[model samples]
Target chain A: MKEIYLDNNATTKVDEAVFEEMRPYFCELYGNPSSMHFFGGQVQGKVSEARNRVAALLGASPEEIIFTACGTESDNAAIRSALEVFPERRHVITSRVEHPAVLTQCRNLTQKGYRVTEIGVDGAGRLDMEEYRKAIDDDTAIVSFMWANNETGVIFPVEEAAAIAKTKGALFHSDAVQAIGKIPINMDGSAIDMLSLSGHKLHAPKGIGVLYLRRGTPFRPFLVGGHQERSRRAGTENAAAIIALGKACELAGQHMEAENTIVKAQRDRLQDALMVAIPNARINGGGAERLPNTTSIAFEFVEGEAILLLLSELGICASSGSACTSGSLEPSHVLRAMGVPFTCAHGSIRFSLSRFTTDTEIDTVIREMPAIIARLRQMSPFGREFLKGQA
Target chain B: MWDYTPIVKDHFLNPRNVGDIPDADAVGEVGSLACGDALKLYLKLDDNKDKILDAKFQTFGCASAIASSSALTEMVKGKTMDEALAISNQDIADFLGGLPEEKMHCSVMGQEALEVAIFKYRGMDIPEHDSEHDHGHAYPDHEGTIVCKCFGITDTFLKKVIETNRLTTAEQVTHFTKAGGACGGCIPKIQELIAQVLGDADVQPRTRPEKLSNMKKMQLIQEVLERDVRPLLWADGGDLELIDIDGSRVQVAFRKACAGCASSGNTARMVEVKLRDLVAEDIVVEEVSA
Candidate 1:
C-alpha cells in the first residue's frame, strides 16, 4: 500500500539531501571534535559551520546556539537554569497547552515549592494575555511558553509575552519545536532569552536539537562533563546529526517562502474540502493565527481513534485528540484547555503538512476523509439521531 | 501505537452487526456524549423471549469499543438470556486474544450493555448496594453513588466490574472501569473501594473457630503468625519472631528494619489484627525485646 503520511507535526522523514550531506562523517570523518589531532580538528570546523548555518536561519550569532540531545533537553536545560540562577524567585509561569517537555518540567517545579502559574487559552486557542501579564512578577524565575502548539497548530505571541516578562526581570523561553522551520524567526533583538528547536521536527535526523541561549544569560550546565559546547552543554558531540541539522536549517531558510505558499495552499485545500464535504464539523484554532502547514478539524458525533484506524487501513496516516488514541483516558490537554465542546473534543483530527507534502497527498486525504467520518458517524448513536433530525 | 490484536482489527474494520434492530425487544444504552465512548445496543429476541435471535449495536468509541461491541453481538446470537448474562468482560477480551491493559474498559463496557439489555427486558429490578447515583433510569440502573463524576460511573458499577475482573490495584480499576481516569479526585475513593473488595476476599481463607480450648487457641495464633504475618514482614526486609503465647496474649520481637523503628507500634497492631482475624476475636499481640 502506498502510505500517505500526514502526521508531520509528530515527526518528519529525514530529507534525502540532508542525509547525503552527513553521510561522509559517519566513518570517514568520525573523529572527536574535542581531540588535539588534526583529524579531529578538521571535524570541529564542520561542526562550527553547522552551528553557523543553524544560527543564520534564526538570525542569531553562532555562539548563541547550544547543541543538546533533543528539543526536550533544551527545554529542560533552559527552565532549570533560570530557576538555579534566580533561586530566590519563588514563581514560574507557562501556558496550559505546552508540549510535555516544558509543561511537565514546570509542573515538577511546583513540587519544589515554586508557584507555577499555567495561563489559560481562549476558545480559539489563543493565549490569555491579561492572565499572563498579571501572573508574572519581579519574583518570577522564568516564563516558558511554546511558539506554536503541536496539536492545534495555533501560534502564540511569545515575543509579546516575553516583553511582559522582561519588565519583571524574569527570563523568557519558547519551545519553538513546532514553529522553527515554518516561521521566519529573528532572535537578534527579541526579548526571548532562550529558544528550543528539535532536528527531527525539521528534515534532520532525530536525537539532535539546538538551544539558542542569549550570549549573556546567567546560566548553569545541565550536563557537567567534558568541555563541550563551551562547557554549557556536555557529552561527545553528535557529529553526523549536527552536520545534518545545519544542512536542514539552510534548506529550511531557502524553502521558507514555499512553506508559506505551496504547503499552505495544500493545507488550505485539504481543510476546505473536508469542511465542505463533511457536515457538523468545525476547525480548531480556526480564528487564531496558526502555522500555515497545519489544520485540526473536529467532526462532531464521531470518535477520533476509529477515524484514524480506518484511515490507517487506507494507508492514510493522521492523528487525533481523542483519549483512546493517546494513552490517557481524556481528550488532549490542548483541546481541553481551549474549552472545545465535549461533543467535538474527542473527535478532533490534526493534519500537518510539510515542504515534502505534495498536492496528491493532500488530495488523497481530502477524498477519503468524508466517507470515513460518515461511516464512523453512521455507527455512532449520537450521529444517527442528530443526522436523522437534520434530514 | 496500540498493538491491537488481528481479531480486534478485523472486527473494527468489518464489524459483525453494525446496525440497529428496528423493532427490537430490548434497547440498552450507556455512556454519554461527554464521555469519549458510548454504545446503544438493540437486541432482537426469539418469540419465547428466552433466546437472543439477533443483536446489533451503534457504538461511538475507539477501535476497541467497536471491536468489543461487535464481539458481544456475535457471542450472544442464539444464546439464552441467562447464558448471555454469564458472559464476563474477560470473556469478551479473551475472544479478541487480549486487549491492551489501558483498553480493558472497552470490554467492561460491552459486558455492562449486555447485562442492562437483558435485565431491563426481563423487567427485573437490578441488585445494587451503593445508592449514590440512583436516579432510576428508563431501565433500573441502580448505579449507586457516583464515584467518577467525569465518566458518570457509580461505585456500585465499579465494584461489580472490579470484582468480576479480580482487579487488585487502583490502576487496574481505572483501566477496567475508568473510575480514576480523569481529574483523579476519586482515586482515594477508588482505593478505598478496592480495599473493601479485597477485604471481602481476605477473610475467606481461615475461619475463626466458634469454640476453642486455651491450648488450641495458642497453637492457632502461632500458626497464623508463621503462615501469614512473618512472610509479609520478611518481604520488606523485616521479620518478627514469636516469643511466647499465653491464652489471648501473644508476644513477638521485631527484627531487621522493624527493630527500634518508630512505626513498630503500628507494625505490632498489624500483627495483632492478623492474629485476631484468624485466631480469636479477643486475641491481643504484644511486642517484647528478645
Candidate 2:
C-alpha cells in the first residue's frame, strides 16, 4: 500500500535539504561555540548565520531570538521567566486551548499562588476577546496564547489580544508552533512581546526551538548552567538542530505561499471528499478562520482511536483527539472546554497537511475513506445508537 | 509500531469476511468504535443445524483486535456450535502465537462474540450466566451499583467470579471479572475487597506451575519492561525506572508523564499489580517517593 502521512501537527518529516544543510555541523564543524578557540569561533559564526536566518523567518532581529530544546521548553521558559522577573504581579492570563507545556506550567504556577485566568474560547475555537480584555487587570503579569490551535487549527487574533495586554502593561506571549511556517508573521508588526517556535513543525529536525523575546523584556533563565544563549538558556548548543532549523526556516520562507495555497486546496479537497463519502461527519471548529492546511472532523458515534488504527492499516497516517488519549476514556479537554457534546468529542480526528502533502495522497484517502467509514459504522454499536437517536 | 502476531498481521493485512452476509441465520455484534473496538459477526447454519456453513465479520479496532475478529470467523467457518463455543480465549491467543495480556481482551471479545452468535442462533439472549448451575459464587446479586466500569462487573459479581474460578488473588479474578485491569480505575476498590475476602486466610494454596518462579518472575518483569511497558511509556512521553527489589517489594520510579501525573500513586500500584500478574503473585510493588 502507498503510505499517506497527513498528521503534520504532530510533527513533519525532516526536509532533505534541511537535513543536508545540517550534516556538516555534526562532524566537521563540531565545536563548542562558547569556547574561545578558532575552531569554536568558526562554529559560532555559523550559529550567528543560522540565528539570522531564523530571525529573518520571523521578521525578528537576530539578537532577540533565544534557542531552546523544543517548543515546550520555549513555552515554559517564556511563561515562567515573565512571572519570575516581576514577582509583584501574580496574575497570568492564557487561553484554555494551549498545549500541555503552557497549561501545566500555568497550573503549577496557580498552585504556587499565582492567579491564572484561563479565558474560554467560543465554539469555533475563537477566543472571547471581550472576556480576554476584562481578564487583564493591572496586576496581570503576562498573557500567553497560541497563534493557532494544534487540534482544531483555528487561528487566534494574537495581535488584538496582545493589544489588550499591552494596554494593561502586561507582557504577551504567543506559542506560534503551528503558525510560524504556514502563516506570515512579522514579529516587529505584531504587538506580541514574545513568541515560541519549533523546528519539527516546519520540517526541521526535532529537539530545537526558538523563543523570540522582545528587547528589554524582563526575563529570568530557566536553566542556569552555562553562558550559552547569552546565559538566557544554558546547555551546549544543538548545532545540527540549530543549522537544520535555520535551513528549515529558509525553506519555509521559500515555500510559504505554495504551502498556504496548494496545501490548503488539497486539504479542502480531501475534507470535501470525506464529507461527501462519509455520513454524520462534521468539521470541528468549522466556524472560525483556521489554518488552510488543517481540518478536524468528528465522525459521529465512532471513536477516534479506531479510525486512526484503520487508517494506519491502509498506510494513511492521521491523528485523532480520542486516539491520543486511548487508555483513558477522557475526551480532549480543548474539545470539552468548547462544550462539544460528549457524543462528538470521542470521534474527532485531525488531518493536518504540510507543504509535502501531495494531490495523489489526498486522492488515495478520498478513495479509501468511504469504504473504511462504512465498514466501521457497520460494526459500531454507538453508530447504531446514534442512528436510533436520529430516528 | 503495533507489533501484531503473524496471524493477526495476516488478518489485518488481508481481513477475511469484511462485509455483511445477506439473509444470515443470526447476527451478533460485540463492542463499538466508541469502545475503541467493535465487531459484527454473521453466521449461516449448516443444513443439519449442527455446524456453521459460513461466517463473516466486520471489525473496527487495532491491528490485533481486527485480526482476532477476522481470525475468529475463519476459525468457526465450518465448525459446529459446540466446537466453536468450546474454543477458549487461550485457543485464540495460541492461534495468534499468544497476544499481549493487555490485548487478551481482544481474544475474550472474540470468544464472547462467538458465544453471542451461537446464542442468537439458538434464539436466546447472550446468557446472563456462563453456566446454568451456580458453581461456587459465579452468579451474584445484580442489584448493587456497578463498581468496575471497564468490565461492568459489579461487587457481587466480583465475589462470585473469585470463588467460582478458585481465584485466590486479584490477578486470577481478572480471567472472569476482567475488573481492576483496564485503566486501573477500580483497582483500589477491588484490592480492598480482595483483602477482605482473602484476609491472610492462607487456606492451603494451589500448586503453581514450576515455571512460575523467582527466576521466571525476573525474566517476565524484564521482558514486560523491555517490551510492552517501555514503549507504552515512551508513547506517553514518559519512562519507568526500576528503583529496588527487596523480597516481594518491588520499587519503581516514573521518569516522565508517569512521574508528573497527579495519579502517580495509582500508576505505581498498577505497575506493581501488572508486574506481579506477569511474574509471580507474592510480589508487592510500590513507588519510591523521593
* Best model per TM-score: 1
Give candidate 1's error at residue B19 in angstroms.
Answer: 1.2
Which 10 consecutive residues of model 2 chain B have the lowest summed lDDT?
A: B130-139
Candidate 2's error at A257, in angstroms?
1.9
**Model 1 in CAPRI terms: which quality?**
acceptable
RMSD of each: 10.1, 10.6
Judging by DockQ against the true structure, name the best candidate: 1
Score residue B138 of candidate 2 by CA lDDT.
Answer: 19
Fnat values, one per model, are: 0.91, 0.23
Off by over 4 Å in 1: B125-143, B206-290
Q: Write the per-residue lDDT of candidate 1 for residues B1-290, one digit (tens) a residue.
A: 89998999999999999889999998777766667887888899999988999999999899999999999999999999999988888779868867888998889888888887887788867553121232122112454887777666688877887776666688988888877787898999998998998798788766888999988887888778766786566446577878998878888999867899889999999998888787788888889999
| lDDT, each prediction | 0.88, 0.77
